[model samples]
Target: MATFNVNDIRNDFPILSEKAYGKPLVYFDNAATSQKPKVVIDALVNYYMHDNANIHRGVHFLSQRASEAFDNVREKVRAFINASSEKEIIFVKGTTEAINLVAATYGRKNIGKGDEILISAMEHHSNIVPWQLLCEEKGAVLKVIPMNDKGELLLDKLNTLLTERTKLVSLVHVSNSLGTINPVKHIISLAHQKGIPVLIDGAQSTAHAPIDVQDLDADFFAFSGHKILGPTGVGCLYGKLPLLEEMPPYQGGGEMISSVTFEKTTYNEVPYKFEAGTPNIADVIALGTAIDYWNNLDRPGAVAWEEELLEYATSKISAIPGVRIIGTAEKKAGVLSFVIEGVNAMDAGMYLDTKGVAVRTGQHCTEPVMLRFGVPGTLRASFMFYNTKEEIDCLMENLGKAIQLLQPQTAL
Candidate 1:
């Protein structure tokens, strides 16, 4: 395995060199999305310039090349997650669409009136809303797995939650707002005991750690390419082959159909059936390059160095009188969410912007978590493998300045 070298990795992403707010950019909103590396960018250019053609239909040279390149990504995704087959992998717009596809298809078919769907309090809006829509349509109830002050899931309550009527459990593998890495393998095991399927929203977890779906025994796993240094508008959903084959197609159109007659239309096979219409061909092809970029890097080394950065930042931020950390879980990923006393998160974010530090200031699409924490929102600083401890120092220095400027009297 390759060792973690921050300087060399940073050089691979050209955006790291650009200036924002008149200073060198210190991007910390990685949970929102990651910056693309040069290789992925070049892949995009290469596809458009050379292999510009529609896939799966044309028999011409460029079309065959494009189709080959596009379909090859599916195999990479299958291998990346250790999924049993490429047919189990379905391409969607991103994590949101992937979740919705399952909810609309498998969920609508499996869940019925008075049935239950279980989720956690820390889920992003994507995980919450899809099931809510499905429940509203099917007369099902949504059950929540509660959490404690540390933002960890209350696993003790899970036994009662997973009843016979419970149809499915969709939860986040990592809390985007809190940076809490949930014990998903344990959660999956517990759910399996009830013979209930669990779909892990791996949008936050995929970029931070190694994911082996077979080892986790995940029923369904979803993640986005953009979060893993790939292009936006392209993501993957990994399902157990049996489950995917059982679920109905999410959409209809070309490529997803095996036969079309005046009387009836026959849907295509498992993964292709779920994927309808002309897909995001170029972005899907570039995602393979993104996966290669991630595969070459030393993931374990990055995780360790990232934990060091988080600890260092947490210690320094805690020392500041007004700063309060939100998620204090023993296990966390590459996110640090906090609030400053007497300062609006947006104002603080804007203040940091002047110093060229990019951080997200919002509920992070996890409003229930915000309500639980008794904060309107938080200033979130999410790190990645390329982020450095020196950047944390810079953030702290600027955060102190922002807080002082926000409260002139307190500084005096």
Candidate 2:
């Protein structure tokens, strides 16, 4: 296991050492997608080089090897999140598909006309749109839990929202744009009390903190691999065994079937039922390597260092003129979103890029959050454990220059 020294951890990610525009790269766009670790990259290469075969179907030696490697990742995901069984873990493209799977399957089964689905205000479009589609299809209503100016959900309003007609509560564990760490466990308990199942969108939270589905008592949880230092196009959805069994399959295809006649086909059991067609074979194995890298790190130390980075960056940036920090939650994770008074966010972002600082500037797929905060968009600088306070200094220096360059000259 490697100690959580930022420099040592930084070395494991090759991109961190690369030059961007002839300057050292300072990657603060982790919330959009994390940089891949070398071990994860190696795993992808090794699989393609030696074990390139379709999984779970072929009887050849390469197929057997690939199948074993693929199936082993399911178990790793089960243990990674402490899911009750490997049968509860289903592989999807990413969190968006995972939420859609539930909305299409369990929602269509249980939800009815006039029923309600509760969600928070600070949801990514991925979380919001699927529920809207389900509601529109079923004549159901979508209810939102409002957040305060600080981006904290008003939990006091939850009881009123979780009514008899409420079918499910889907919440984001962390705000991708706001950096707020939501109390999803408490929200889950509240939903469970009303016999409403809860699904947590854990895309941002999974990489920053430890997850135990059993401990959280979450009915379903979804997260992406790319957000956790793994390869893209693969992710996990953890559902309770009973709920998954009761729900219908999201799609119809090869692996999700048991037997097929010309007239009717028998579906496979639980997790397999949700996985349709050929899966992302190489990326899934590479995600397992990502889990291994996470498990072997000083996680607690890394978390503390990230906190320090956020704090230092926040204080430094807040002190500058024309800077208005958005998402001022008392409890935030690795995100720092703000808007300059006179400069457009996109212009600022591009200016930062020329200085070798990569940040995201847009709605961040959380248009509702932007609407709530009354901003068109924001410049979001999200951090990770491997990031350093020195890198933050570079962000502040470059941002100061961007503001001066883009800000309109006042009436002289």
Candidate 3:
């Protein structure tokens, strides 16, 4: 494992010191949501405490301060994703909202009858549902790229699926349920070859990996700030500027309009055109601090350490009797999901919780992937930079106990 100042990193998160069931909290549910660092929390508190004001329309000092803060976050997001310009980054609720915005605006605009939209089998429900809705509404066809048992997409089949009829290809940059890191670069290139645009659901991948949207040439990319240790209700959608300008506004409200005439209303530029109303201002401001926190870290080293944790956790848990490790993708982030034979995933999760080790149990918003694997769900132990090997050891110990308790019932 790469040596890191784990104690120092742990101190940045205040909640990590809390006790759950007399045991210190060991958060392993980072894929669902990460624990906030003190910096992000402080940023949020500071915004509401001092600079809270409605943005864009106000000429007052507080309003100008709030607007600058909010727009500064947009610049931070632009830099975080390496977008061509800040105008491309539209703040939304989260990845789901971003996808829905694209589907409603861009999908509705471009997709037509008999056109096809391709997505992978490993997409989260958020990615899947929006496109499905768009396809239904526009009379377009939804094509799925199949995956192997290893939870990796079949590239060979991807070629066959992409025909001249393909309008767009939306896929996850990383699988939330399986922890598979997809080859989005290749996928984007392939789609571009066919004159099809691509939207990458980057909700899971943004925190763990460095992203360069300009280099990737993706048409759209969406991610949640909360997934990367920022506050909830703050996320970004990065769309190519030309496409964003062409698409209509997602929601009509105060700030999105440039001029309101009784005859016809003029909309704002690319980003403000899509972002309507007062956004999650406090959370949006805090997201900039979250990006700062991530930038301060030794990212490659952190990811390397988390990869060690994944390998160690996988090796230790897989050794337990009747434990089946799922999503054994060669390239993955820090997710470790598995099923314990004869035990309900929820029961296992509950048992682990009693031991003060947090884990996510269920289809993890990817029921289609779960169904593809022929399982109800799996116990998922996802890691982050703050997670330690000792926590993984505790998880392994509790998992053994969980299996032992359920094994007798299975034998009966």
Best candidate per lDDT, number?
2
Ranking by lDDT: 2, 1, 3
Measured on C-alpha atoms, candidate 1 has an lDDT of: 0.93
Off by over 4 Å in 3: 1-4, 409-412
Write one digit per residue (lDDT tens) for candidate 3, span 40-138. 999988998999999887999999999999889889999999998999999999999999999999999999999999999999999989988888888
Q: What would the per-residue lDDT of candidate 2 be over residues 178-287, giving only the tens digit for each residue? A: 99999998999999999999999999999889999999999999999999999989999999999999999999999999999999999999899999899999999999
The C-alpha lDDT values of all candidates are 0.93, 0.95, 0.91
Indicate the TM-score of model 2. Answer: 0.99
Off by over 4 Å in 1: 408-412
Tens digits of lDDT, candidate 1, 1-412: 5688899889999999989967999999999999999999999999999999999999999999999999999999998899999999999999999999999999989999999999999999999999999999999999999999999999999999999999899989989999999999998999999999999999999998889999999999999989999999999999999999998889989999999998999999989999899889999999999988878888788888888888888899999988989999989988899999999999999999888999999899999999999999999999998998888999999999998889647444
Residue pairs with clashing backbones, model 1: none
Candidate 3's TM-score reads: 0.98
Clashing pairs in 3: none
In candidate 2, stretches whose alpha carbon ends up further than 4 angstroms from where it belongs are none
